[model samples]
Structures are given as structure tokens and as C-alpha cells.
Target chain A: MKQSTKYMMSDGLAFSEKRDLKRLQKKSKEGWHLFSFLPMGYNLQKGEPKELQYSVDYRHLQDGEDQEYFELFEMAGWNHVCSEVGIHFFVAPMGTQPIYTDVESQIDKVQRLSKNVYMTAVFFVLMTVVSYFVSELTTGIVSSIFHYILLASEVFTIPCLMMVASLLYRKWVKKS
Target chain B: MKSLEQLTDSVFYIMAALVQPKHGYAVMALVEKETGGEFTIGPATLYTIIKKLLNENLIFLHDESNPRRKVYALTEKGHHILVKDIERRKTMLSLAERELRGGNAE
Candidate 1:
């Protein structure tokens, strides 16, 4: 058997983490379990139908920390699914306590995610500005190169900015 | 994460449990058991708080021979902070109780 597989588009976690997790839960019930994360979406493999709840946590693990980190979640009944970048995904039976139980820690999770997003956004914004200035100051093939750079940077900068804005808004909402 | 100015319920429970030098999972189980399942700390939350406490010098690693189950215990500073938080909570409880008992009926 070639193994059944499919892809599902994500709505961008910074905008819709809750919606995405809920969708994963629904897919698990239909026997399509998430196999791994793909850029902009998920790669799912067919499996035994299950009633599971999914959650995402953001943290940078240091050397020798991953073992204890995963163990803690396992002991709490959450089975580790996969991790991409600093985002980790876990699943457990429905009604299991959520991974984040307090508002302070929940806010901290958002801040860690925001920190990563903010750095990327800053880089893209700088690229966009630098390329725009160089494209205007130079001419010929060199100008075209910077012009392309400006366009590419803008493309990335817009979404990065939106993600940062959304994350900051979430942090503010949680604080209030 | 910044040092906690006040212990949140989750942190309070974890701190109280760590007074006995327990591992991460042990802390979670103790909190759930002591609270009669009414209060519980999820694993991630417990881990985050434990790290914060460690960073703030409120807790220390009691044993790490078992890397997967490092035990933690409260530091002297941690005990002092915990005691202060308990006193603060006690004051709040007393105020609520007095009002509920019509100490200042109006």
C-alpha cells in the first residue's frame, strides 16, 4: 500500500492557531492524522479514527532539556506529536487539561512566539527599505536587482507585519 | 519570563508541592491530589513555572542523576516568598469572610 496522504492549508497560525488545532482534531476523528508540518499547511496520513484534542506550545529547548520537557507532557497524558521550529504539537483524549493552565504562563507563551516573529518582521522591513532606496539611487541591471529585492521583501514584510500585529493584539487582549 | 511579583495559583501550588523536593510529574500529581481534582496544573504550565522559579532562584535542582526526572525543591528565598504570598491570601480570605458574615452589614 502506498499509504494514503493529503495536505491541508493552514490559515496562518499567528492568525488562527485555535482554528487550526480544532481542524486537526476534526481530521483525527475522520482518521486523517497529522503526520508533520509543511510550509503553509500540514501533511496528514490516514490512521485509526480517534477522538483527540490538539494543542500547540512555543518554547526554545536547551541542550538536555528536551527529554524532561517531553516527559512532563507525557506524564500529563499528552502524547507528543511533532515539533517545527519552536512550536510543539501534542494530542490527548478529549477533556484532558489544557497545556496552559494559567494566564501568566499563557501570556509568556505568546511572548516567546512574538519574539521570533518580530525578529523576522524586522529583517524583512529593513530589506524592503534598503532595497527601495538602492533601487531608486541606482540604475540599469543593478537597479532592477534591487527593485526585485524590494518587491520580494515587501511580499514577506506584509505578512510578517500582520503576524506581529496579531500577536501583539493577542498579548494585549490577554493582559487586559 | 520576568520573576513573578506574586505567585499565581498554579505557581503557588507548584511551590507548595516542591517544598518536599518532587519531580515535575510528582508536582502535578500532588497538586491534583491535594486539591481533590478541583485544581490542576497542566504539564506545560508546570514546566514553565518550574523554569521561571529556577531562574528567579526560588527553586533549586534537588537531584538530576535521572535527567528525565530532575527533582526540585524550594530555595530559602522561595520559602520566604511563598510564606508572604500565603499571608497575603489569608488576609484576603479573612476580609471576604468578615463581609460575608455581616461584620459591616449595611
Candidate 2:
């Protein structure tokens, strides 16, 4: 019963969802099947190396319908691997139909994921602004150390937001 | 009731495939066959559409003795919509063919 696991960094924000899917597929072929999704990475278990087509569907599973949802995919021959919040991951043998068959549906899925990222970015930005104002009011000057920390928060979120915005623009406006 | 105009190509094909009760893979295979391999619905899209169709009463799950596969069939509303869409396509084709024939006569 020898089992081994590895902590592989996965994009939790899902901004690079397509890349992550490719990575997962490649990893699965190398005998690292994803067994769990941690906050900052994926936990993969050692398994027989096989070619698998990994797909991620950004959907908010409603209560009481989770079983049926999985069942539908299972019936379609996709094996459910794991899920993180609104993102569900599945893998199937090569040549299995993609989760999204049309451009419109693919765009819809990306839009939903982008919306979640946008809201999260907004929350982080709002928190930083509020904290900055509070610190300035209390100390009569924004503390340099805390200010840097707050700015660092923006550093990651702003770029992530930009990535999502550009992705949506490319798909919708440019029709790429 | 959802408008027929709102039904995308994938939804339309899935509904057509369900004229007879079918499981997920069967619907995919039927759609591919009907379209001459021009269209294929993936598992994710099919699953989502199935849920939407069920919610709209356009389709219902058929109870099958085999518990492994869940079968689905078109409801009356779904059949009516499919028939209407087919008629619309036929009418459009007739107009196009009439123009083509006129050009050939010229």
C-alpha cells in the first residue's frame, strides 16, 4: 500500500484556468493524478500513468443537485476528480467531448469565473482603502509599514483583475 | 416557457436527440451522427443543458431499470418546440432554393 503525494502549485484564483487544465492533464500522464485541491496548490497521488483530458467547469453547484450533476458527467464518461469552490474538475480519456461545445458556452463559463475574480479583487481593494483611511485618521499619518502591506495586496489583485479583463476582452471584443 | 429563439444549436440538437429516451453518451453520439460529425456536445455542456431543460420542463429523466445510466426524454413542450424549429428551417430553405432556381433560369 505504498502511496506518495506531492504539493504542486495551482492557480487558486483561476485566472489561468486553461493553463492549469493543461498542466493537470500533463501531470496525469506523468502518473500524478490530482486527488485534492489545497488553497495554494494541488495534492496529487501517485497512480498509473495514462493520457487524460482534464477540464475545469466554473459552476456554483447548488445544494441537493451536486449528486445529479456529477452523475450526468459520469454518465457522459467524464470522471470527476475534485472541485474548489465554484470550480469543478473532471478528467476523461482522450477524444472525450469538451465540457463546452460552442464558443458562446465557453465564453459564458469564462465570464462567470471572471465575475468572481472581479468581485474578489474589488473586496481586497476596498479593504485596503478603508484600512489606509482608518490608519491615517488614527495616527494622523498613514503608517509606512502598513501602507506597504496594503499596497502589496493591490499588487497581486490588480494584475489578476487585469488578466481577467484582458481575457474577457479578447474573447468578446476581439472574438479570438 | 422559454422562447424557442433562445435555444442555441447545441440545445436544439440535444432536444432532437431526446426524441427517444437516451442517456448522456447516446445523445452525444446521436447528435454527432445527425450532424455528420459537424457538431459534438461535450460532457460539461451536455450536463448543464440537461439541468436547464429539466428546469424548464422541456425534458424529463426516464426511469430505467439500469441504475447506472439515467435516460432522458423530451416532454410535449420540447417536441412542439422542435417541430416549430424544423418548420422554420424548412421555410428558410425554401426561400433560398427559390432564389437559387431563379438565378439558374437567368
Top model number, TM-score: 1
Summarize candidate 1's per-residue lDDT along B62-98 as a digit string, tens digits.
9999989999999999999999999999999999999
- The list of candidate 2 runs beyond 4 A from truth reads A1-3, A11-13, A140-156, A173-176, B1-6, B18-26, B33-38, B53-83, B99-106
- How displaced is residue B49 in candidate 1, in Å? 0.7
The sequence of per-residue lDDT tens digits that candidate 2 reaches over residues B1-65 is: 23235677888899988999998778887888888989888777787778778888889988655
Q: Write the per-residue lDDT of candidate 2 for residues A1-176, one digit (tens) a residue.
A: 56588878976545566678788889989999988887677888898998998777878977755675677677667888898888777889998767777766666667677787778778777767876766665653456666766787777677667866766675675245
Q: Which ranges in model 1 have alpha carbons more than 4 Å from their true place?
A: A1-3, B1-3, B104-106
Q: What is the TM-score of chain B alone in each candidate?
A: 0.94, 0.82
Tell me which residue pairs clash in candidate 2. Answer: none
RMSD (CA, Å), candidate 1 to true, equals 1.6
Per-prediction fnat:
0.85, 0.58
- The most accurate candidate by DockQ is 1
**In terms of TM-score, how similar is model 2 to the real structure?**
0.77
